[model samples]
Target: MNFFKTTYTSKLVFTALVIFSSSCSDDYLEEMTYGEISPSEMTSPGNVDRAIIAAYSLLNGQYDASSSAFNSPASNWSFGDVVSDDAYKGGGGTGDQNNIHLMEIFNTNPTIIDIERKWVALYEGVKRTNEAMRLLQNSQEYDVALKENRMGELYFLRGHYYFELKKIYNTIPYIDETAATVNDYAVSHTQYTSEQLWDKIEENFSNAYERLPNDQEEVGRPNKMTAKAYLAKTYIFQGQWQNALDAANEVINSNKYSLLPNFRDVFLPENDNSSEIIFAVQHSVLDGAPDNYNGSIGDRLSAPGGPFYSQYGFHRPSQNLVNAYKTNAIGMPVLDNKNLAEADFVDPRLDHTVGRPGIPYLDLGVLYEASWARDLSTYGPFAPKKRIVSANSPYQIKTWPYISALNYYIIRYADLLLWKAEALVELGDLEGARAVVNQVRGRAKDSQYVMNLEGTTPAASYRIETYNTPWTDQATAREAVRTERRLELALEGHRFFDLVRWGVAAETINAYLEVEKTRRTHLTNANFIEGTHNYFPVPQKYLDYLASTK
Candidate 1:
């Protein structure tokens, strides 16, 4: 189950040395002691490779101590899903992880520790990558090819972390390898606009694309195609339509990846490195480590909330999200708010993505029940299914029963397809956009629908179809692309960012709250202010840390 396939034997020794070096007095310089390697000692090829592995390890966002539930979670369910209309903050009550509850209702402030922890953890990733780059430059044993590959990894990882920060906080301080001390954080977040930050992100990915090889020896290591996908994604985010289209076309023409035959298999541990995944936070269990920290920690809190699973039930699916899967008579998405039960057709992905009552949940052999929910009065009956560990999966780490070693996709082939579709729509190539969207829809139609215990009947009225008509206007094409993104990427944690990119978060969330309040009364006071709530405040501690430098 170990995706890295090998452990960094020198990682612990390197970390200890770094810690020891940091605390030593400048006047009384410390020498490299027994079993310790100094920065100079890292010039060897073996040590430098280990340092790169260490950088890769940080991608999981584990080992954070700020909070058990919210500190640097890789899944992003709380921030991305709950903040949007896709999910609810489900737990014992609103009092449990109250900061997240406040976030869910748009009441969290700049001083909250949860966001601070996320900020810190992501910067920690940046630091690790920078350290690797610094070490690579100093390394004497690596050849030109090796050094370029290492640099490619560093740039891609740094870009990935900064992208996370950019989506979370629209304005953030950008730090690079030049930062020699903590004082560098004193730079103001207002130094650059959101668009400028996007440019910085693009720069990193473009460099990565240039240097990274077409493929990697290791499964999880990003390749040239991976960087191209991220570059395309960044262009889409910045509204650079032609640039996005070009990058997307490059990826498509590469023919290096494709959508999986079945949608559900994309998330299963057995299919960890399937062709659909572009980049993922590689996870492993029982890798002879002290703890299962490398397992999917963000989803540990999201395991079903009953005696069967016995884990905290966070990120419960919203009724609105379930309704989004409903299809009309022609098998297109129901644009109207009709009774879900009366809908003659539904997208098969609904069953794949959510666990509602009476459905055979995974291969667990138990039909889902309302009793599985932690709080029926607040969070509805549906449980998040896409990311949770299946009981039967061998990759499930029993020591940490809630954790799964399944690779969480950061970018997937389907996402690239959608981005391309969006670009085509913006470029007034409606037919081209339809072609791309239909590719995704056709895959969905051909993929597996949910099945019952007897295995002879469909779980629900499953019938999803691609667009039958042609040549739609930009508005309709844009709407279709947005809706498809919602359903396709639902609980994987891109909903909130998608809404923000479309400049419709406030309008969509407010309307969602108005309707959802009538059903789940806990949302009665929910609101999404247009300007302020669009992005989380820059944590006050970051500002304080910056101010102290003066």
Candidate 2:
């Protein structure tokens, strides 16, 4: 949510600035920083742009935690396999946030700090945008058409921030205008019923869609399609299926963006900023403008262990998730009761989704033996891709050396396609859904992941089998899509909330725990009561600050 903001006071300063500063869209964060005016000399535009960057910089999301060079959610954490009692670090921060932690429905670990930071960061982002909105609403700068064109991006940012907000924290305190100081920071939060909040969120995104351009020469900023894409997501979650379909179709029809031929380019640094990226956190390591590859998710997932290296493999593949990958003797996917001998390196998706057992991890052969099983010996059936590196970098100066530095991809066309397919399923359009689903499946074989490297057994041509999602009925389709999402978006910090929104916590999870008995070793089943488990207690610290009366 707050992609990358830091410190409360910093948040307060930047956030205050965001709400009051006046900035144009592209220049929103790029105000004249060098050799600028004094306090009395500085005007609105100058204040707004810097403030906008401050919001993006601190939104708990500057970089992808999963895909980063070194994972930072504490090595002993149950980072990826969250939502199961199977993973916990015996410490308390905000897990009590609403039984969201106790139930394993939410990753109570502060890595979910993105949730908090994004809330503040987006509000800050909104502050900057609202300032611009307020300015352009009556400014003498540009003509009305030019003003609205600029306002399009500002509105998109505000709406996008709110949409981002409601997804995590349910009913949030709504702020329609800018906030500049302590007095502006209301002691009490404004309340909106969930429906009403979504209404405001929808209105902003709708205005954004109408105002934002269909295409931008640059890659990151919001476009008409960008606004629509998120609105479609918001609408689907709100259960406004028809509107969801229409919003998605608006982007699909725009012809400004298209799926890249190879799914891999979507993650490449060079390939980003393309027409396909409707919206992205425009990260630039160039000229040190603060495009942080430093704390990203991709780097963590791919990094071998070192000083800056955070060993988060402490989160393992649940036997349930592993078995879910298992296919019968027939070459297809299935969910059922099975024995280990029958599972002879079968379901290739298990490798695709996780670096466990049969997947390739650069220098490491296969994953499980290399990392989890504690078998340093040239291991058994599968060698775990030990991301924890014992290899010493000769000229090491920085934190971790053997770490891979791929940036985190928050929204990609692949996910959008899946979202579209999932929404179509809910709206009773299976055939339409299948079209998008198969496109992904067809390309799964080409995944960079090499499947059957352990060459003792029989090998036909089942090498790059990605997580499969066979089409089914609405209920089953939703399950398939969710499963696919967990697999596809695994470790990129997604599944916990999916379980909540789908309302599948008690059933899908306990059922898994019943079979995967190992998880019980880390969890307390009673902690996860049903109803309250879906939310985090609105940070108690936040409430304590409010006045007694109003």
Top candidate by lDDT: 1
- Candidate of highest TM-score: 1
Candidate 1 local accuracy as lDDT? 0.80
Candidate 2, lDDT over the whole model: 0.48
**Per-residue lDDT for 184-229 in model 1, tens only?**
5457889998778988998999899999999898788999999999
lDDT of each: 0.80, 0.48
Residues 367-480 of candidate 2 have per-residue lDDT tens digits of 333444321121112211222222232211134323322233455666677778778888888777777766665555454434345745422224334335445567776666
